[model samples]
Target: MAEQTFDVHVEREFDAPIERVWAAWTTPDDLRAWWGPTGFSCPRAEVDIREGGSIFVTMRAPDEWGGGEYHSVWEITELDEPVLLRYIYRFTDADRNVITPAESGVPAEGIPDEAHHEVLLTAVGDGRTRLEMTEHGYTNEQTRDMSRSGLDQCLDKMAEVVSAQPR
Candidate 1:
């Protein structure tokens, strides 16, 4: 029997420095500004941010889109200054209790829970940062695509947020 794997990888270039890009992900205020997709709003942001710590976000959908909050926790596995980060993404309840994909209204197959993620950053010239995000181990195609779309939008918003900040 072969195990199935679905993965997502997205890359973006920011006009800001690698430190700015890293701050967008690590700072709670910056995270709250652009944590979700285009139509989604982030209402809550909390972080510990060390190698064994976690980042938590409450992503709120718009009222017109059937308002709901999706809570997520990223358990940090590795932290390397402004260049790299590794974490495990998980759905969680309001109290930050981990939930399975099914419990989170995700239609998953052949997997119980969790996705491993890595964020890589490189300085391009003096004031640009090339960023890459990789998420591995989705259970199915549909789930992977849905996640990818959200991630893309999040990065899009991140670029905007970082660009607006003074370098």
Candidate 2:
């Protein structure tokens, strides 16, 4: 029998150019400005925009959302300027120590040890940019659904951030 796998996908269009949209994602300061859910905040972010690079981000949930910090790292696997980006997401400690989801306050059950993410950017026309994000490797539907919600919220925040950038 085949194993069950779940994935999360979200897409959004912005009024900015592809260059601005790409920079908003790859720049650390821009990431910190709008990396988490609506009520959440990213207090730390470090991005190395190259193949085989790694990114570190610290996200803090609001008091109503458990009020804790979650540290994560994204191991970049592929990169295409202003077009495509791919990485593997994993939890890590503040000091760069790898940790399990349980240690990071993330639900362990139904969550994969490592989630794969792929982001594609396209210029739709008239300086508009379309961003498509996909995250896979979930062990169950519940985890996938949860991630989908988070991703959607993150993009909603991204829309505001990118739209404000000078295009």
Candidate 3:
């Protein structure tokens, strides 16, 4: 069988320059204001913003997914100011336990130390920036399907976040 692949790319023109766009991502306070899907607010924000830094955030929506929802903690593996932010993001439970692949029924041995996720930000000049996000690594077709769908929602949320930012 062929190796399964999972990738997602999202792009948009922001009314702000690359510097501001970069700030929106690196600064915890700024990021809290506009991160994740629309209407899902972040009540807590923690970010190291460097190579191997840690980022933990809680996404809260009044009536989203039947109630507030949370995304697993993400570890920053590579950070290049105003350009790249790469990390492994895992989906977890409230207790912070890595949900097992058996639980998801995808033969995942729990979220691995490395999961496929990376963000690329490029300055397109003229005060506009293009953001491309790619999620990699899915050994199975089923897992790839799930990753594709989820990433669509994530990009939609990202569009909202970028649009909401001040120029």
Candidate 4:
């Protein structure tokens, strides 16, 4: 398999500089404030914002659906401050426990070393940053279908998080 994957792309024109936008991502407090969809909040977070660092967070819904914990262990493969950040993200529990492919619904055959995840933050003209994030290694048809339905809402939340922040 050619590393089947699903991607979510979000581009927003912010009235902020690239450095400030980068801070929104690298700073733990700023990240927690706007990491998810609108109205959702992260009451807990632990992160080390450096190469080979990790980030763990719990997303809580404002409504009564309750909230589940999810985590991603990232190794900053490439970092060009305020320009780009490339990393591998894996699913995990609230405690930053890694979850295997079987548990993550990804078949072993499709998993690639670069299949975890790739998030690219680029400085588009007009003072905007284009954020492209992808979650790969999920070749299973059912899992992909299920995730597709929820992705837009998730990205919307992420955008909302960014919008709510002050430059």
Candidate 5:
């Protein structure tokens, strides 16, 4: 039998330069400004931009959306300033305790404990930057679809942030 695979690829072009886009991702303050979906907010962000460093972020849902927080961690595997970033992502609790998808109220049928995600940034000339994000290792199609939708919304928020910047 063949193995099943699930992945998501999202790409977008920002009016801001590559440096600005990279800062938005590496700077905690800039990241918190637009790290989640429209109705979600990033209350905290801690980033260490290095090959072996880690990033932790707290995403909080609106009052109407259960009013809880979800913590996520990214173990940086590779970093090339303003160009490429590779990491493995995992969910955690408020105390930084690693948690499974079921523990976080997510269906656990095919969701892996950790997934590899990567971001590629390119200078598209004329002060524009192109970002390509890919995340994979999902065990089930449902989880992948849901994650893709949420990621799309998050990227939309990021675009809004980039657009408001002083070019």
Candidate 6:
């Protein structure tokens, strides 16, 4: 069967340099600080920055959100330092066991088990960076919408973290 596809795209401009923005994405500490939505917290993050590298993170929801940990992994497919990063992302259990969309509470009728995400960063001048992030293969419109909103919240947190850095 041909692969099904849908895309969620977001673009944001930051007042920091491209390198700083790249660091915010590539660095484990920075990722842990802002990788989840406003009410979620990332308590653990492990990253290997290279093509074929793996990134693992645990995002924990608050008690009001059911108080559980969501483990996710990213298998890096492409990398261009401070410029572009691409990967395939999927969910796993605490032990790193793969979790299918249906098992993870996502509608599985059309959605794929994994999604492809790409981030492109450009130095738009004046020490500023423009970030273009796209996640493709969402299959379901509602899932895509929810993901976009959560991603937006995460990026907002990232902006707050990066914007507080020393220039």
Task: Identify the candidate with maximal TM-score.
Answer: 2
Worst 10 residues of 2 by lDDT: 106-115
Q: 49 in model 3: Cα distance from truth in Å?
A: 1.0
Q: What's the lDDT for all of these models?
A: 0.88, 0.89, 0.65, 0.59, 0.88, 0.88
Candidate 3, residues 1-167, lDDT tens digits: the string is: 86455455556566667777777777777767766554567776677788878677666765845555564667788888888888887655555566654443334632243575777788888877887777666655566566566556555654555667654
Candidate 6 residue 41 C-alpha distance from true site, Å:
0.4
Q: What lDDT, from 0 to 1, does candidate 4 have? A: 0.59
lDDT of 2 by residue, 61-145 (tens): 9999788999999999999998999999999999968898888887788777788899999999999999898898888998888
What TM-score does model 1 achieve against the real structure?
Answer: 0.93
Q: What tens digits encode model 1's per-residue C-alpha lDDT throughout 19-132?
A: 999999998999999998999999899999899999999999888977888888999999998999999989899899999766865454543378899999999986999999
- Total backbone collisions for each predicted model: 0, 0, 0, 3, 0, 0
lDDT tens digits, residues 18-64, model 5?
A: 99898888889878988887899999999999999988999998999
| Residue 51's lDDT in candidate 1 | 95
> Candidate 1: which stretches are off by over 4 Å?
106-112
- Cα lDDT tens digits, model 4, 48-166, are 76667756665666666455444455656667677777677665565666776455443444343334555566777766667666666555656555444455555565455566675
* Candidate closer to the true structure by TM-score (higher is better), 1 or 3: 1
Tens-place lDDT per residue, model 6, 76-165, is 999999899999999888787889867765346655688899999999999889999999988778878888999999999999878897
In model 1, the worst 10-residue window by lDDT is: 104-113
Stretches > 4 Å off in candidate 3? 1-3, 61-64, 93-97, 101-114, 138-167
Residue pairs clashing, model 6: none
Displacement of residue 45 (Cα, Å) in model 4 is: 2.2
